[model samples]
Target: LEPLWLVGHTFAENTVGRLMERPPAVFATGASVGSVIEALREIVKQRMVTYVFVIEPAGRLVGVVAFRELVFADPNQTLDQIMLREPFSLRPQQPFVDAMREVVKRHYPVYPVCDDAGHLLGVVKGQTLFEQQAFEISAQAGSMVGVEKEERLATPWSRSFRFRHPWLLINLLTVFLAAAVVGFFESTINQLVVLATFLPVLAGQCGNLGAQSLAVTLRGMTLGELRGMSKLRLVGKEAWLGLLNGLVTGVVAGVGMYFASRGQTVADPVWLGAVTTAAMALCCALSGIAGATIPIVMRRMGADPATASGIFLSTITDISSMGVFLGLAALLLA
Candidate 1:
């Protein structure tokens, strides 16, 4: 058995090499099972053993033998006869995230780390890999709102401020854009005061729709589910979904607008309701398209998709929803 050494490193710094430990049980392929058992007896005293690695005389991994297999094997039989040949192994230099995606379904207790030539280096426990990945997943939520992945509850106020302020500034700039859109339609809003009342309703609904799309896209990206799929297909699918969802929700909102504007004199209530329906459906569909496209574009541009994604998403939804709603009112009622 060998000692387990813990190395402190961030998730980005982790690789199979840094996480692996010396295997407690290893034997040359030609070693007899009786000799392997004898060796295991001594190895078990110092560390836990699960799978016994079998390698060539030159230290290249050739097979793996489970403890259960060894317990029932003939003492005189060589390891090659019972060991599973060409067992799965992770490369020492592979990123921990990449390795995780490969082994997620296998759920092996331990994975052997190897070099390009299949020389055994060490082994990593499944628990360690999952723990690291869990931290990364948790950090992703904060990152979406412009929080740094490295920030913690105990992070210094100054550092936290620095990490957060820039994103807020960016968010403010986007908010101003949305504001500008509303201001551009100020005359229309004044003419139809009811439109002003429903501005928040349109923005809120579209924002929620966009957020739902963003969440699904980010989850897919994190799980490597987006690999090999056409980006155009994904975006198109989201847009279609958005359109369907918008049609349903828009009908409800349009009914609400009809009642709210019944006494208004500037425009016919029925026309206002129709305008709300059209704008709601169009803006919601656009929100979905923006939600799916933003992350994909950011990733292609070498930026973290989750970094301040919410801020950007809010900006798009606000501008589009306001612009479309007010424009429709001006066109139909003014």
Candidate 2:
């Protein structure tokens, strides 16, 4: 009789009988098929089994080699001698798409999950793995290679950002905004030629310092190793780091300006130095805050924190850096 034809209470009984025996009701195949039959009998002694499906060599699933078949065949005959060999067999480790194709073709209920070496590890049945993870991972596109996409999604969200695409878009937008900010400063840049010379050196150092703090914050969030108190501590550290970075970058830019424009005319550079220093410091501090907060905020909002984190961070750094620089210049230079 068909396993599905049973009614409610009997269905539970049949399922309980099938799943909880000394060993679960697993069908077996391959060279040691006879030994598997004995294993099933041992399970029957515990009132656990209703049947076993044994397969033949070459991994073809022969007819259902149930308890009755075992009883009739052999006090002594090896499974190879009595087992059916001409049967349906799926390649172990078949591509999931291919397995789905076969399922439609063959009308099979279960497909084995296996290693490339053809050793079976588990089974996929009735769209279970797909139903669980396909929505989240189908964006991965095309066939999964090596590790299964199902296994990949099983990892925590923080560690799974690399698999997603939103980060790349955010990065493009942020960088464009930063570039626009630099373009806005073109008039000031042309008037104060020395400032143009030092722009990169100033921004480069600030960018590095900002990036370092951002990286620390992101890693902490991703690892699930940060607590509320520790986050406050991180912010404090980044603040101090911003100040340190501002001092170093300012000094470098100021010294370079002092030397590069010794005979050239510009405004009182003491004023320029002060404002540049403050802007660098402010930008670094804000970058650190933006870096640390964006991911945490994303997580709180029930989104993937890491997915667009890098882009958001770049945007924060760019906008803040340009705004601070120009604001300070307008105040001190104009």
Candidate 3:
């Protein structure tokens, strides 16, 4: 703890403590700035404290309320009046990996940890957090790059890369699976080039719909706001949405295609029309499945559904959409 910087409330007052080797100092005034810097000087005189944190009146994270901000605020003002509101905070029970991510994203020297209701718990500085991660914990949490907790004063660039690559690899595998679906339908694609033209449009629309539902669900999950057994109810709602959207999109695309290409001697014009309608419906249905199932499954498996496996979802949508469209095309036009 000697080498580590401990703050009563802010960073500036502690310089004297480093020089004189003394006890830590605390904020004398409730004012946000003058008190914090004054407190910093005291910490330095005492030599035990290198930082100071300013807590708001109600213990909510108003701001880190740094010396810089304090300097700007009125010296006579209380912290409640001068303190910045809605500062980013962390949860005590959060995985260090998650903490690391927030720290890196915010580029903060320290992040405050709090309970669910916004009560202050402790502060984790960027350097110390990195140093505290043991080798085993780091390994079990996967690579320690972006969000993985780094417990050391300085984390190497290469070490950060280790954590990021695994997710990239997972993304690549999901891409390949999607590509495999396209490859499986090479014959159907060859027979009906026109169907291929609309394959993407149908699949893409459904994929988007499903993704919307997934996003709402996941957000609800994260906030602990999705109470009761309403998850299935929510999924059913999206399914109904898919049906409506599918009907509209299919009819519109089918009519547009038929009228736009009326000049061409299109084989099975009626069949083509029917195919478009069916493909849209199927695409929407499958999209809902991919959207709803993936997140639910990820959650059940104790994985972050928000790691955005959109690529995997897209892959599923593409394959399913293509398979349905081409299979129908073959039977109708063969």
Question: How do the predictions measure up, each by TM-score?
Answer: 0.85, 0.51, 0.54
Model 2 gets an lDDT of 0.55
Q: Write the per-residue lDDT of candidate 2 for residues 1-334, one digit (tens) a residue.
A: 1121111212122121111112134453443455766666677776545435444344334444445667677555555555554434444334344444445545544443333344333334445434433433353221111122443546777655554434455566667888788788777777676666656665666666766776676666533467555666777778877877777777666666556656645566666766677777777777766666766677779865555455566567767776677667666556
lDDT (10s digit) by residue, model 3, range 33-123: 5555665775666453433444444554444455565567776676656554566766655665555545655766556655567655556
89-139: candidate 1 lDDT, tens digit per residue: 998778877888899999999998877888888889999998878877888
Off by over 4 Å in 1: 1-12, 152-159, 222-237, 262-264, 299-304
The candidate scoring highest on TM-score is 1
lDDT of 1: 0.87
Q: Rate the local accuracy (lDDT) of all candidates.
A: 0.87, 0.55, 0.60
TM accuracy, model 2: 0.51
- Counted clashes in each candidate structure: 0, 0, 30
Please give the range of 10 consecutive residues that has the lowest summed lDDT in model 2.
1-10
